[model samples]
Target: MRSMHSMRIASFRVQNYKCFVDTGEIKLTPGFNVFIGRNDAGKSALMEALSLRHTHNPHRSLETVRTPTSEPPSSAPTSVAYDLSPEELRQHLTALASFFLPTGPNASASVFATFRSLLETGDRFNADWANGVVVKADLAGLGGLRRDANRYASVLNLAHPSDVQLALQNEITGSYSSYGVVLANWLRDKAYAFRAERLGLGRCAAGPDKVLSPNAQNLAAVLNVLSSSNPARYKRLVEHVRIVFPHISGITSVIVEGSSVEARVWSIPLESERSDLSVPLNQSGTGIGQVLAILYVVVTSDLPSVILIDEPQSFLHPGAVRKLLEILRSYSQHQYIITTHSPTLITLTENDQLFAVRRQEGTNVSTVALIDPNRQDDLRMSLADVGVRLGDVFGADAILWVEGKTEETCFPELLRQLTKTPLHGVQILGVDSTDELGAKNAQRVFEIYSRLAGTASLLPPAVAFILDKEQRSETEIANIERMGRGMVRWLPFRMYENYLLQSACIANLLNAEDASSGKAVSSEDVQAWMERHGGEKKYFAPREPTAYSDADWPQHVHGAKLLHDLFNEFTDARVSYDKVKHGVLLTRQLLPNPSGALSELCKILDELIRGAPSYTE
Candidate 1:
């Protein structure tokens, strides 16, 4: 019995192709591999080049191009191409030759394969050759590699190893059928791309020469065959589609006009039972069609498949993109390559699977593999100065947008004080605009937070808002009241006024005994005393005299003193701790959901008790 080796993309390399003027290599895995880059960045080109190299089909070949319609050709075909400069023709042929070049050579593109299970022949003889395929050019003749001539001779003669060189050449033999099988399966799976006109809106099936139509004109007929030949598989496919699109209550296949086979989707609406919402296969939404196509390729293809998808995020809703990523990841035990520009999709992937592709001037493409530095918080922030919201651009669990480093540096300490716990996965971000970007950007971070607030998901920490209130208690209170609800909570304090209010209350309370007792000071004296202690009474009025009592006055004084002590401890520099403390006490009462923020603040008290390094330190 022959043992089966797991199919893997041993290596993928590209050079001087399309946007890639420089050489680039992408190390792939048996599982999912992702290619990420900005628009027009050669991600799609890379996928196509890899496919072209592995499949060894000529560019503009009928096999590579999608045929949309089932109509027969109107006339006999003609191959007319003669005009070409010596250099231009040389380059073109070299490209054609590169497709057949073996791995590990100086070729425009190269791929190597090492089968998982070695074939033990009756004679124990196996093809021992150079590392798969390599590309060699006629540097002496045309100032370019001679990969085409080398591979062309090899394909012409199966057993002649001496005549054909390995440069840009892959191993070919009767025994190494797995490669061909995988390639054929991939082509068949992806062959589903068809245009509206070619859909043969009436043709049930083509002659024996053609396979399944990309636009699925023969979907009904194909189902009819499957139902008879493999009824179980057909049933399973329908069930899977229904699961992916719950709105699709059922699928009914029919041979419509022109004898074309089509699948009709039934929708379950509020007033009606399942009704036909069957959009013609050609007229369905691209997202729905793309999804169905991808799912079909992933599940039903018979060979060990390595699905390569470029811009998998296109046309997908944000939620659907996420679902697609999850599904891809789950099915990735088989090989697959997905490329995307969507940051949301990037978040669904891990750092290892991601490859950041960048193109330099002159169209030189460079790829950073192994690990993405943008995966780290600090490196991502480094890109912020250049106007890249790296956090949003890369999909972080939460984005804490601060004005600058001071807020960035102080947040962890603040959270430690509030939660009395460590801040592990929270990502601190700096954005120039919350109003321009709006709360929407910030809301994304919070959504992730809401998901993790009480759950133990692998997701990062909850994202919380910490904008400087500009010293205004009213603004801080109002903003919190507006945005705080459910699991989403904004931290109190936006402006400097919140602390000022607390300072005034504390000052008045402190002076109460001094006034009521022999040393009891009047309101005027209290305001004057605060002025001497760095208080901003000019900007913030003290609480009314009636708002305090002798006993309550002492309590307020103690609150002010505590604030002063805590503030002094946290910041070595002098801060209006009394005012902040006084405001905190008042703000706590004003907050509809103060429990969360207050609990966080109380942890600060415990930290002080435990003698944790003060903010000043």
Candidate 2:
């Protein structure tokens, strides 16, 4: 086996390929190389061109590669096969003559003399490049058998032209196998290309697969193969999937109902009372099939020097997306070329993985900005600090995406707590799985790593986020942070509302609401309120009920419920659930106070603002 990091497309040169009038040279490295470009910007075309070298079709024609230009190349480049000119034919014979010269085995005989004698007479009849001009061979005499094998040598008139023909028709040396010839065939095995734009992971076929299909219809079979062939690699694939969807217990191949072979991911709920569940790969998220298909190809194919993946970041959890990129990096022996629109994908990519691609207006030709080798790190870090996602630095905010409206409403209030005065400029916003007006995760600072990851990108620019810890597992949280989205903060209290529910704080709020209500509330009343409304599973839901007494009511009472009940118990102006946010805001006015939990949480929020990337209008 080759070293883990052995294959890479050092550089690529293409001409007359679709959309690419002619991309001169694209240098690549053995890692996650991302191509960031606009639609119709030739990103896909570049990937297609790279895939061309591995293609073998005798009938593949050059017409498909034409630039769609007004004038095509003098001749076309064919996909299936090539048609070599007479000049090209002579070069092959000459190369063979050089290798088989009168030496070694034929030390005294000088058999090559017969081959050179025939090369003197070349193609004088047909001249494609030079119209109406012809050059004849100089050969006067040669043996019949040797002269016939070098037929193109006479046809070319000993002239040389760029050869396109890949097939060899004859071997004059009378050898069934030649070192150069056999080695050339073996080299093709060292590299190949896989285009996955339209992979069909679910289109079922009853039988097992000899190899994975382009659409991944045979994904299950491939998974089975990988497991049997290399268990460690198979385990790594499962680990990658687990990072994307943490609930997954394992991945397996199953022959369902006798005919259909399927890849399935099984999930075991965090709760032991729940039974483990399994879903067919096709029935799972589209990203799952895509991720699995890619891993199967890269990990098991073992032949390709380069892998071309277009928009690989689509439909992937930000964690899975990073995991996929890391796989490409770890397998540094092979090269990866990827195109993407996801900023999350760009977030974790190192500077070298980036390639900013753009097409000139009204032109099919696209070009990549060459990052100067010397300034790559500085330039990359600078872009990252300024929040240029996937090479696009737009007008966005240095906002914070937090849970609950209280987080949003508490923004100005949070600053007041920390600074003793409200600070303006930085914004704090809230968004969730449900599409909210003005809540696009596009500029989200931190996306919650729940099933709601699909909607995470639909937010205004916080350019960073810190998901509140609730049912989230530590591993899941760490996986999300590893994706470089943002920090995940565990609330010091039961929830954000708990910050405002402290006994001392509640006592102070009651004092503000009613002078007579200034006295501390008994913990028994707080517990009573929780037991009453806690069935609804609001912010204060806990698995076990804990009793509380005076001075500790806030520890047990739901903050919003406490405020609601406060008005009913004392002051009479109706306090609705909506008004509790205002109540929380009011409570924050007394914060960065003596309360340890609320104050500490406030400091963390304050530091988040200070540390996250900031953008301008």
RMSD (Å) of each candidate, 1 decimal: 19.8, 22.8
How high a TM-score does candidate 1 get? 0.43
**What would the per-residue lDDT of candidate 1 be over residues 318-378, giving only the tens digit for each residue?**
4345445545554543566766665554332221365666555453444434435335654
The residue-by-residue lDDT of candidate 2 on 125-176, one tens digit each, is: 1111111111111111222233222222111212223432222222234433
Best by lDDT: 2
How many clashing pairs per prediction, in order? 51, 36
Best candidate according to TM-score = 2
Q: What is the lDDT of residue 217 in candidate 2?
A: 62
